[model samples]
Target: MAGAVQWIAESVQEILQISGLTVQTFLVLCSTFFLACVVFNRSRNLPPYPAGRVPVLGHLLALGRAPQLKLTAWRRQYGDVFTVRMGMKDVVVLNDYTAVKDALVDRSELFASRSPFYYLFDAIFGFGKDIFSASWGPEFRQRKKFATTVLKNLGMRVGRGSIEDNIREEANCLRNRIAENNGQPFDVAHDVAVAVANIICSMTFGKRYDYEDETFRELTKAIATISIELGAGHITAVFPLLRFVPVVNRPIIKALEASSKVKNVMREEISRHRENPRDFLDFCLLELEQQEKVAGLTEENVMYMAQDLFLGGTDTTANTLTWSLLYMTLNPDVQNKVHEELDAVVGKSLPTLSHRSQLPYVNACLMA
Candidate 1:
């Protein structure tokens, strides 16, 4: 009877040990299978992106540094239109100008929906209805038509004589500053930027500041800084997820804070002129009143319209003028032709709008 009891206990112990081992082995196998699926499943829906990435981040790791160069290289490697998956988002890059035109202009409606990354702009400026950054919809079209009309009314049909005079004065000041540098190695980028900024300032607020003025300098610096950062490859528009990554993306947050202050300053200017307005602010206020009658334009939309004027009128002209001087200085023949034309028409006096047509060569030089 003792031997029988001992044998039964031994059999029970062996069965329990075998069951525990089997359960452990099954769990290990299940875990391995799950991990494998996770690794392989990421590539399943992806549209043939470049190889190399951690489990879910698909090529996002590569974008941690010099993303533009990497994008360019990917274009070189995988042709112009390759897919890049970043945290479940599949971004298709249209590298060629033709593709971009086709998307932005041809099938504009389908692509008109601004990408998800534009949320940052909306969050920062509260500008979901602005013409430039707004999503494509009825509101966008309304704003677009209004912007076109206002801009045309301001400058297109008749010469903006007052605006031109303001620009001319600022441009003349810029030229004198450059001349004062006496061809020394100085950064003319800032001076050129300030001239352009003052042009917008005059257009918006009916005022222009001197080059030596501290407030004006701050405004221009802020503008230049914002513009360059916005265009940089690391911009949040390019990688929206970067906004959440604190250690790697603190600069982005700081920039947003700075930009918000700048926009506030702009809004303060608008508010100051609410009672008595002039120039473009006056036009915008009038538009807002009209929009109120129509019950179509929200305040947010109106503000974005103001933002568009400030951004569009400032940065583009600045770049054009800067590049014009840069190319003219680089090409002596072009520079001499410009000087000759100036000598013939303006003759060391400040160039006026009337002399513009007469000085075609100078105009051509500028165009170049």
Candidate 2:
């Protein structure tokens, strides 16, 4: 019995020694990591990092629902520039207009590259083939030039079969849609989105869909899903390693599925455009045929380019219009002034781009 007890005690002592060594090793590793971080920050001369940054997660948990508000608060505390640790990456935040302009406008070429850290957008944009997520390089510059030229041509052309005509038609459709509500309370967000999306559809596909069209509805839903999932999966964007976790990656999966749906629709449209040769897709296809090898203008690139245009054009414009309507609703005085300006300047006629300079107040309101 004494020998048994001694054996058990020896075993327990061995286990305790092992545990002590393991803990000491872990502490050393942690200290080394933190020391490396400090050294790296000092070497880079990084801006002020916020307090309360936990290991691994960094400031993510503190960001809460409205990260902008938190960032604004941080800006006040840490000046216009600060280093924010997001997950495992250190990000430099630029606040205020002048700083942003200095970086984006003055040193535009230096900051033209998109961060490969945006894993969600990278996936949606097909691994940087799309303009929005593409790295700043020869291929991106060529694509940008092509897109700018095409858009400029489309925007400049006026009268019957032009982009202006498409916008006017969509505006009329929106007006009719509102009129159908019969002065009753109705949500205008979806209708506004549909109108904006239709304008893009017309520009891209040389076709427009009825507001209730099933395919169009599906496309918009997918886009909306992607937007929502992007927000939901922001954590994964910062900590891309989390994407491997089953439960945590639900949003990423949904985004991928939504992106697939949108891409499938775009692919179908591209196939149709191949035979008929119409609108932006045809323009892209023609370019692809000529410069496939030279400029990295592949079918994949064209499809992604269309996706970028569709996403960029639709959501932003719809959100802006919706917010303007909401602002007008909230501020009756401002709305009245805008109404007076429109009535005086536009005077029951369809307002054209030519009248923009004439209606300064309206332009100010729109700019605001």
Candidate 3:
């Protein structure tokens, strides 16, 4: 009996010792992590750190649902430039037009490189392969130069076979699609997205898909999914370490799946372009052949570049058109003025880029 009791006592002491060691280790690690954060923050000549920054998470919870409103409010308090701790990183916010222009236009070279840490860019774009997420360097400059040249060749000039012609054709298709709704309440988001994406498809693949084409529908759907997932505010974006957690990483997974779908379509287009060189993909392939050795222009780079163009062009344009329509519906007076301008300037003819100068109220409404 005494032996059993002594054994039990020893076991209890051993368990307590192990528990004590574990707690001590945890405290040490936590202390070290915080101390590192403090030291690193102090080392940099960073902008003013906003208040309510807790350890590790650091203002993430404070961002709330409408981060833009919160940011605007913070801008009022902290001026155009202020720092917000987003999880482990210190993000500098530029609120006003002047600061934005200065950073993006004037001192563009200094601010050209994207952060390599973002999981979205890393996973979807492969970090440096694409122009959008690439670091500012020779590879980026080469891709940018090629893209600019290709865009110039694509020509937005007001004439037959120009981008304007393509826009007019797509616009007509969109009008017809809307007419099918018979003035009833129906969502035009998908139609608008399809219209905008088709323009990009025409530029990239030298062909546009029918609105009912299964592949085209899938492509647009994937692009839309990616756009929504990006803005869906995944916790993994802030705390990348939490990517192991399934619920936290669901958005990232969805984005990856969407990206894969887009890439597969791009691959098919690229293969076709290889056989018959035409449009953006063809142009890129030709450039890749000449500059592959010097500029690190791989097939992968070409694919990603095409992906960047599609994603960048489609989402922003579609969203703008959607928002403009929403505002026009909300403010019929402004819409009437725009319609008056369009009627006066464009008349019964197909409106072209040449008519832009004549449509002042229409331009104002669009800008508004």
Candidate 4:
């Protein structure tokens, strides 16, 4: 380690001597690379970004450790739509609901292009080509079309035996699991996460895993770890090169391993689907068979799409349900109202789509 450090120091000394560049000057030049990129490429009509941007690091210092909360503060100051320079990448954040709706929904096509995450997820974690991360183009369109068709075919849309049914079944399973605990106060977080994950599993993999299932637990753990690591808002996202560094890269190794396990399971299911197509996998395979095009529906695309569905479906729902439970505990009046309405609307009957209209309060509670 000392020798490596000495070598680096000597190399720096030689470069400084030859270029007649001081340490500060060299550092300044290194940072100016990102600043120059940001200044030259950005248009005048672009959204306002927060000030105090450093060269390579951009607004990272100003944003501090909790970038989300800091960005929320910046949003309040800068207005609904504002931009930020994360390294050389110019990110436009839609802070308010109106601006977000306008950008993402109203003029979606104009702003639909997905900038690749170069740092970790793209280079190392191996999801650069997935449906979620792929740039808006023919590839993304075809993959999305196929995936949507599968989802719709499996009753993800409207009417009976829909995604709601899938969720309701899992919710019942969750209730039963809780009942087994004999009314003892146990942490519902993990059970909720597993239940939510199982819904996605039933859709994608054709069946649900028991909450005690080892493989399911491992995958969820990996997904949770990935969420935490990615949520860190590390410099790696801004500076793609940093992902290669051991320290920055180590945290994601578990996520990648988990992804590998997930893809292997997907591949096995794809094989089964090829022989006798079952659920979403079968639907995807059927569509892929039609095109037979390598660009759109390759095995790689299938694996990535499956990963997207699994990750996308698991995290957000788990978070929302978990938060709802927390709020229910805090606000017992609302909780009681929800329960009372449920009892009065359909006593001794399993809730279904028809019950939804009769129980507006229940719907509102879930929505809230």
Could you tell me every candidate's TM-score relative to the true structure? Answer: 0.72, 0.79, 0.81, 0.78
Range of the 10 consecutive residues with the lowest summed lDDT in candidate 3:
35-44
Clash tally, candidates in order: 0, 0, 0, 0
- Per-residue lDDT of model 3, residues 236-309, tens digit only: 77777787787877778888999999999999989878755568898888877777533778899999999998
lDDT of each: 0.70, 0.83, 0.83, 0.77
Which regions in candidate 1 have their CA more than 4 angstroms from the true location?
1-56, 60-82, 86-88, 95-102, 118-122, 125-127, 156-162, 176-187, 235-242, 292-296, 330-333, 352-364
User: Candidate 2: deviation at residue 284, Å?
Assistant: 0.5
- In candidate 2, stretches whose alpha carbon ends up further than 4 angstroms from where it belongs are 1-53, 59-82, 95-107, 156-162, 275-277, 292-294
| RMSD (CA, Å), each prediction | 9.4, 7.6, 6.9, 6.6
* Ranking of candidates on TM-score, top first: 3, 2, 4, 1
Report lDDT (Cα) of residue 161, candidate 4: 59
Q: What is the per-residue lDDT of model 4 for residues 124-233, given as tens digits with 9 covering 90 to 100?
A: 23455677887787777877776787788787887865788777788899999999999899998889999998888888888888988987787777777767766776
Which of 1 and 3 is ahead in TM-score? 3
Candidate 1 lDDT tens digits, 1-368: 99999998788668768877565676787799986775456434434577665565667788767889988888888887778866545677889999899888999898987664644455644556667777788777777776666556555344653356666778788888989977788878778878887777776666776777887666666656666666664635545667788775765665576566667766777677665545666666776776643237755566666766676667677788778778877899878877887898888788877887898887775565
Which residue pairs show backbone clashes in model 3? none
- Please write out the lDDT profile of model 2 over residues 121-178, one tens digit for every residue: 8899988888888888888888888887776566637554457867877898899999
* Among all candidates shown, the one with the greatest TM-score: 3
